[model samples]
Structure formats: C-alpha cells, structure tokens
Target: MKKSFKLFLFTLLFAYQFSAGQNQKKIDHQTLTWIRYYNVLPLTEKWALHSEFDNRSFVNPIHENLFVIRIQGRYRTSKIIELGGGFAYFNVNTQNPDADPDYSIPEYRTQQDITFINDIAKITFHNRFQLEERFIQKADKNGLLDEFSFAYRFRYRLQSTFTLWEKEQNSLKGTISDEILFNYGKDNKRNTFDQNRIYAALRYHFTPNLGLELGYLKNFQRRASGVDFYDRDIIRFTVYHRINRKF
Candidate 1:
C-alpha cells in the first residue's frame, strides 16, 4: 500500500512539473534557504498550543527575504480530526539584488484550519485545510510601505509520514507533502491560483516529543494577474520540540 501510494504521488508530481514547463506565463526562478523553530505546549490530551519562527533568505548566493512568526491553539476532537486557529506576521523583501532588502512588505494573517490524521499500516497520513484573511502592506505613491489591502485565501495540504527506522517510538521518518493555495474575496479578483508547494523531508526523532526535519521544498506562485510566476527552490531545516503538562 505504501509503495503504491508513493508511486502515485511521484507520478502526479512529475506530471505537474511537466505541465509547468508547457505553461506560457512569464517565469522567474530563485533559491531560498529557510530555517524554522517549532514548539508545542500540550495543556491536556485534547488541547495544545503551537508556535513557530522562521528565517528565510533569497539573493542568489545569500540574503534575507522573509521572516515569520506564528502562534496557534488547537483542539483535538478525535484521533482523526482537529481544529486550530492562528495568527501570523510576515516581513517580506524583494529578491532583486538592486532593491533594498529592508523587509518593506509586512503582512498580517489570521488563519483557521481543520486537520485529519490517520494511521494505517505504520504510515501516517495528514490532511489539512486552511482559510486565511490577510492584511498585506502595499507601497504608497512615494514608494514607501504605508498602505495596506485585504485578501482571503484557501489552502489544502496532504502529507504522509513513514518510519524508515525505529527504536521504540523514536524513529527516523520520511515525509512528503503537497499544498495548493487559492485566492478569493473582493480585493483579490485576478489570480485564483495563488501558489503550490511540494515538499520532501526527513525527520529524526530524538524522543517521542522532539525531532528535527531537513527538507527540500519547491514553491510556485503566480502574480495577481496570473501572468507571471515565481518558482522558488528552498532548502529547509527545522527543529521541533514539544512539552506535556500533567494536572
């Protein structure tokens, strides 16, 4: 079953890439290096808080492009379903070397998500659907970042985790995930296909609650008009930590 699923995913990814090559949109390519720190604070068997910080860079060889901070509270209604809401702030800069990388673009986002987790034959599948309301900074007539606009988006991600090697619950695992983003609302009219991300990673569990993930992510995003696209190749490193409190 695992092999069959993996094969299907790879084939789908291959087909998507092939279609991308045939697309007529103007394309730009860049490399982004990203590192993330993630933490979970468990209040009870059914409740938890999640937080994350990220540093992302893109400037050919190296330069800062973005930074992000997010916090979320989650309720696990069942082993197979969970609900979460979060807020995030992002500071973004253009990747152009000639442009000042001062993080001129600041975005505030509120998000809600529904997640499903199922374990089957030592493999775990996770599906997450998210809706976001965004307040994004824009440039004024003077070219200063003093204006803002609102937009809404929807995203869906499918991910799988397989244990490659194990020592009790501490194991080395591999993960593959793909996500698609769509835009809506009154402010966003031109581009419906906002972005897509494909990720492959390896996670090493230090304990039942702590782990590290090293991964590669490919991201494609379209401009509001859907006439231009950005293809980003990202190298990602993440540290994961969790704490459980007993009452």
Candidate 2:
C-alpha cells in the first residue's frame, strides 16, 4: 500500500509541472510578439534629464503647423518616491493666406511620481501627479489675454516592461501604458476642458541606454472655447537615451 501511495504522489507532481510549463509558454508567446519603447526615459538612478522635439501636421488645409519642444528632469527622493518638473513650448503657424500670423504658447509643469518594484519579475508600477500653467500670445486677443493663464491638470499613467531576449549587445523590450487627464481652473473654461490619451509602443535596444520607439497615440480633447471636440490619431517615432546612470 505504501508503494502505491508513492507512485500516486509522483504522478500528481509530474502533471502539475507539465501544466505550469504549458501556461508559461503561452504567456511568453503572447507578450513577446511586439516590443515597445517609452519616450519618457527610465529612472534607474537618482537623477535624470531628457529632452525631445516633435512636429505634427494635419490633413486639413485651413489648419496650422504644430511644433513642440519638451524638456524633462527627474530626481529620486527614495526607493519608492520621485520628484520632477518640465516645460514645453508650442508653436503654431497658419498655412492659409487668410489666417493670422504665427503664434506661440508656453506651458510649464511640475510633477511627482511613485513606483513600486517587484523583485521576482522586476515589474514596476508607477503613479504620477502633476500641475501645469499655460501662456498664449495671440495678435487678435486684447490686453489681459496676453498674460499667462493658470490651469491645473491631473494625470495618471500605468506602465510595465518585460525582457524578451537579452544578449551581450542587443535586447528587446515591450511596454504598455495608458494615461488620463483632467483640467481645471479659470482658463479651462469653468473646469469643462479635459483630455484623454492612450499609447502602445514597441522598442528595440541596441544598448542598455539607447533605443528607438514606435507607437500609436489616440488623443481626445474638449476645448471650452470651442463647440466641437477634437480627436487625433498620431503615429510617433521617438529616440531614447539615458546618460549618467547605472542599472
């Protein structure tokens, strides 16, 4: 009877191992199909600085050309907390001959983020909160309109990374993240303006600190000053590099 019991226990263990292995194989296949890279540089160390420029154009003939410059800085306060701030400048130039001349807008923001890392899989969960103010200069608007207007914005983003294959000189990473935004204050037109953005990307890294990212972005914005809602589909290509960090 004791010999029979041992045989049964061995069979059960073998079956459990086989099932777990199959599940892991399925997960690997699904997650590794596409690799993703992030434009927001990873904070692997105590301090980081990053900057990039983006240009966008629309199919509409009456619209304007859009160019954006972004600068970001981050500092780690602790194992789980981080503080950072950045500013962005936007330039919009009209294409139509009947339209007004070029105009520029500047936006400044400060933010804090917290992260929790899991040791086993090395997965990290990041939470971010921020505040921003924007200034717009237009030739048509009067005196007070030229002044900077204050608007408060709140955002939440969740992202994760998984290592597919790591060799001596090359690696692939897959990233998935989503963000939601809310705007408040006087310039937000009585707290009615809001925006929602979502992105999915794939990245290939030739080195640990340098890589390229290609992604799709969906943006929805409601302007309090306008009657229509603006929806945009954006294809983004970004280059990422981290300097002065050890991971």
Candidate 3:
C-alpha cells in the first residue's frame, strides 16, 4: 500500500509538470531568498490563531522588503470535515538607486479551507480569495508608479498526508501538495502575476500529532503580464501539532 501510494504521487506530479510546460513562459534568472517562522495557537474548542513572519531579500542589486500578518479561526463540522476562515494584511516597500526615495502599499485578504480524512491519508483543499486596494501616497506623488486601485486574486490548493511506517515510539510520514494562483480584476486587469507550486515532504513523528518535516518546493511564477517565468527551488522545514478540547 505504501509503495502504491508513493507511485501514485510521483505519477501525479510528473503529469502536472508536463502539462504546465506546455504553457510556460521564458525563464527569469532573478531570485528572492527568505526565512519564515509560523506559530499556531488555540483559543477555544473550535478556534485557533496563526501567525507568521518572513524576511526576504531579492538578488537584484536593488533589494526590496515585504511583510504580512494574518489571523484565522477553525470550526469542526464532522469527523471528516473542517472549515476555516481568515484575514490578512500585506505591506511592500522598495529601495533602489534608480527609483524614488521610498515606496509603500497596504492590502487585505480573506480565505477558507475544507478537509477530508480517510484511512489511507488525509486530504485538505483550500482557497484564498483576496481583494487588494493599493495605496501609494509617496510613490504616486513622485510619479514613479500609479496611485491606487483594486486587484482580485485567489489561490487554490490540494494537500495529502500519509503515514509510511508506524511503531510504538515513532512513525514516518509522507506528504504531497500543490497550489495554483490567479490574479485579475480592475487594478490587475492585465492578469499581471500568477503562480504554480508543487512539493513533496517527509516527516518523522515523535507523537501522533507532533512531527518535523523536511521538504522540497518547486515554484513557477509569471510576472507583470510579460512572457517571463521565474522558477525557484526551495528547501522547507515544518512542524505539526494538534490538540483536542471538549466544551
């Protein structure tokens, strides 16, 4: 069963990549490097809080910074189904010798997710639908970029996790996941940016709900409505924890 599952995951990933290549754009060499930290906190029986911080640097001589914050809640509907929603805030700033002195923009977003569990593995499907109205006070005054407008975007994701080996003390687990994003609407009418990502991960669990994961992430993106693609190879570390409460 374990071998079959692994084979299935490999086949699916290969198919997805092959299909994506047919529509891929020209490659870009610029890169962005970042470190992220995430924490999950329980508030009540069916509520939770999550937060993350990221520090990123662009390889381009002109480096920029991006920051985001989010808060969310989860509700359990049945043994196989869970629902969640959240709001997020985003800010971006750029510093370049050729550009103006400084620039900044802020935005907001909301999202939801559903999950299913089976003996073979657990699956989670989620979507993040966002509306961002950019505010560029300083940059606009300098006539560097447009002032403000609304952009609509959404991300669709599917993820699965399976236990490979289980013993009294520890277990080995495997995960496969994919996400695709679409951006559109008035401010982004040009369909400026989009992203597709796929990943495979392995975990070592000390307990049923606690584990450490090591993973490889393959990400592809299209930027600014041009026929240019950016590909990134990422190494990720993840930690998992779950808690139950009765009300």
Candidate 4:
C-alpha cells in the first residue's frame, strides 16, 4: 500500500510538470473564498446519506464564481470499505475573474464512488475513488441555452486526519488532503488532465456530531484550450454535521 501510494504521487507530479512545461499561454491567477456545509445522516447501521452545499466567489473585487449542491447514498460493506452513488448540480460562472458576471452555466453530474479507510495509531487515512458523468449546458452566440455537452471524469483523493488535542468529547484535529481529476469523452478532447487540489485545514469539534473547519486550498486546473490554466488560491470555511438515530 505504501509503495502504491508513493507511485501514485510520483505519477501525478510527473504529469503536472510535463503539462506545465507544454503550456505556452498565460496562466490565470485568482484568489477566491468558499463557504460550505456538509452533512451526514445515518439511516441504519450500514446505510447513510451525505449532502453538501458550497458557494464559491472571487476575492478582492468580489463576485460569484460557482455554487454546488451534492448528495449521495452510501452503504458500508465492512469496517473499512464504503460504496456510494450520488448526484450533483453546479452553477458555474465562466467569465474572467475581473469581468462582470455574465450568464451562468448549468451542469448536472452523476457519480459513483468507493472509499477505503484505515487507521494508524492516532491518525486516520481515507482513500476515495469516484467516477462522474457530466452534462453541461451550452450557450449560443446570444448567450441563450443551446444544447448539452456530455463528458466523464475520474477522481481520486487521499486524505488524512490527526488528533491535535482531545478533552472528553471535544477535540481539535488537523486534516490534509489532495485530489486529482481526469476528464474523458468526445467533448473533452483537449484537456485530459482536469485539475488537482491540495488542502490543509484545522477542525474543531464541539461534540462528536458537529465540527467546523477553516482551510486553505490551492487548485490548479487546465482549460479546454490545453494551453491555458488557472491557478486558484482559496480560503474555505466549512461546517460539518452528523446525525445518528438509535433504533
């Protein structure tokens, strides 16, 4: 497992370097902020629902960037393995960061995923793999909704958490995660490497069922042009809630 993890990291780094060296066009750099809320509700010992809402915006000058809503039904097969399927909706602002907001694009996504969890001493590791089918609304020259473009994407994330402090039921934790994504299909010709995100956060739990997190995330993305890119620096604030029912 350790060797495979190292290989995966090395491959991602190599691909990123190769792609960066090939891009001759200017890269768009932007600063952004994100506010998010996530929830987990347990229906039974083995079944659960996960839901999330995220709002993203540009900083400094300040304008809307994107808004997302996602939900998933998850089933645990064992202590370490969980399977999930989900749907997501995205409202994307395709305009430049400095430009005024134009017509937003609508996107629908269906996703399937599996996660593997492990623990080593006080630290926990989560390896998640997901596949997404995306239908993105297109616009004509008049900016009217035209047709829908279809694509597929694959995503993988490795996340870890460490207990920083603990007193009774309340605790403080540190989290670090990295995710890489790839795009494919007839519509995704130019950009095969979609994006990579690196995140680090500090989380505080008032109880076992609720927590708040503040994080910094860096997202590097390749555009459909294949030559252009976006380097985004984002500050994220998140609320996490979990509900469990006793039967």
Q: lDDT (CA) for every model shown?
A: 0.83, 0.55, 0.59, 0.87
Show pairs that collide, candidate 4: none
List model 2 lDDT by residue over 1-247, tens digit each: 3432343345345434433444422211001011223255556657676676776654443343456677778787777677777777766553232455545444444444444333234544454556555555433433224556666677655555666677996887676555556776766764353655556777788887788878777655554553444456666677777553458
36 Cα displacement, candidate 2 (Å) = 15
What TM-score, to 2 decimals, does candidate 4 have?
0.93
For model 4, the local distance difference test gives: 0.87
Pick by TM-score: 2 or 4, better one: 4
Clashing pairs in 2: 35-202, 35-203, 36-174, 36-201, 36-202, 36-203
Best of the candidates, lDDT? 4
TM-score of each: 0.88, 0.67, 0.67, 0.93
- Which number leads on TM-score? 4
Instruction: Judge candidate 2 at residue 113 and give its lDDT.
Output: 44
Candidate 4 weakest lDDT stretch, 10 residues? 3-12
**Residue range 1-247, candidate 4, lDDT tens digits:** 5843674587468657855685676788899999999999999999999999999999867888889999999999998899999999999885466765458889999999999988877878888899999999987655747689999999988888899999998999999888888999887899988988889999999998999999999888888887788888999999999985786
- Residue-pair clashes per candidate, as listed? 0, 6, 0, 0
lDDT, candidate 4, at 55: 95
lDDT-superior candidate, 1 or 3: 1
Model 1, span 158-230: residue lDDT tens: 7889989999778899999888788986667777778788899999998978899999998887776657777
| Model 3 spans with C-alpha error above 4 angstroms | 1-25, 30-34, 57-65, 93-101, 116-147, 166-170, 206-210, 239-247
